[model samples]
Target: MTELARAAAADPAAATSPEPVPTTPDGVPRGQPVLDRLVALLDLERIEENIFRGVSPAESPVRVFGGQVAGQALVAAGRTVPEDRHVHSLHAYFIRPGDPRVPIVYEVDRIRDGRSFTTRRVVAIQHGKAIFSLSASFQLREHGLDHADAMPEVPDPESLPSFADRVSEYGARLGDMAKLPRPIDLRYVTEPAFLSRESGPRDARHQVWMRADGSLPDNDLLHVCVLAYASDMTLLDAVLVRHGVYWGLDRVIGASLDHAMWFHRPFRADEWVLYDCASPSASGGRGLATGRFFDRDGTLIATVVQEGLLRIAS
Candidate 1:
């Protein structure tokens, strides 16, 4: 989708017709059991030795979400690796907005399989062109020295406002977007972008509590893939809040340029995790943010860094 299309989707008054309801390929409505549908999305269809096909939710946003593509790519990479190996790190770049109307084809290249580490590269293609690419490294489990920063003292996830509760103030502005099926549950410790933009010029820090909205089966790869999808939901809001500008409320636009994640320890995505995020710099029409994932016990399990295009219209 183009910039104009994004604007139109965000502005209810600009909509020319009723927004379409999302559905499954079998023509079943999809607003409930959202997590089931999400898991299905990650279940890619293998078409060749190293090629797989995945699809987007019906009537998706102007573009397929960045996290969806990233998560799906990881699934493709994981499928080609040995089950004994687990993904330790992944680096990905979003080259273009994905088209949701069609299926995405992921082509995987086995880069290396060494004594302790395995690496794979995946490219997500649509209409025979590359839209995204990722390189992931898997490792055989082994003992390692461990140390991490302590999790800051903050209110528990239950004390914070849910995403729906936080956005209730926006009223009809968000339309069905706010009401759509959400597979991930998010609660904010700080004012969200929409709310912060009114009184902010705040610090470049954002903290949120996140977990899958529903129960997930016991699968290590599935848990990690789910975490990858949840990571992109708000990692960049820290940048916008620092300037007190929002996407629709302000004359601003943004897109993920690249994302990288490192897994430090095992964790369940269905359990609450604190995502502590901050933006250290933004320049040349881009903003860079980093986040650490900590389980409820305050054990750091993962780290993420992402740079995104944040164009402010003057």
Candidate 2:
């Protein structure tokens, strides 16, 4: 078995039964859609005027996914601002790995409320300690000079194999790793970052087409926050792609140190978005990656930069 398969099989709680059908807001059980589950995960329950509590889904057993906290914190920050204002940018730091068993309390601080722009700071507390922090800026819609790098021409998303298909191709090597619930439908344009355990090209740059597994509502904030959650899914893979190392296969330990994103234009999280990612540098046991999100028509929607702690065991 491949190292990844062995690692997955080592976790007794890894492979659970399929998720039960979940009822929607309309009170109809339409099955457990990945997108709906993601939306529910981000939906914070108001605890106080400025404090909201978010829970990690039972599906994630250990540490809470950093993206979930970041997205939920952004949602908390957004809730305190005017509905007309839209998030323009966000910067966040992963203070500590969150304990999934506990609920995270998000405290939103109204940093500034300007006529044209507003800013909010949020702290995610767990076990009476700050585990994450974020600062986001919002602005009213306004016209501005616009230009962006053209999206590279690549195979359409429909032409690429789904992540499950690729994993299945490995047969028994991947074991039940293939059964892990995928919230995003990812279609890799090149060899996947995790497939480096076998023979493959070592390319620092990568591209993938991704979208929510199911349709989302028409809420703009929901879409943006969903993208925020998706953004963390693959960016660090660029670093592994560079060294030809897979996370579980190569004994590589990694976690996001900080994340930043700038919204460039409007986007729909449920639509096919091309994630163009590259690792510009890796040193001191850390790697930096940048990515651009583009719509099907090649319109740049957002740009993200992240630094991660990547250590390889000898």
Best by lDDT: 1
Question: Among all windows of ten consecutive residues in candidate 1, which has the lowest summed lDDT?
Answer: 23-32
Model-by-model lDDT, in order? 0.86, 0.83
Kindly list the per-residue Cα lDDT of model 1 for residues 1-314, writing each as its tens digit: 42223333454332332236444333333332566668778888889989999999985888999999999999999989888999999999999999999999999999999999999999999988999999999999999798998998989999887777787777357555665567888889878888888796899999999998766666688889999999998999989999998777778889999999999999999899999999999999999999999999999999999999999888
Q: Indicate which candidate wins on TM-score.
A: 1
lDDT (tens digit, per residue) of candidate 2 on 82-150:
889999999999999999998999999999999999999999999999999999999999997989999
lDDT of 2 at 177: 39
* Candidate 2 residue 217 C-alpha distance from true site, Å: 0.6
Q: Over 4 Å off in model 1, which ranges?
A: 1-32
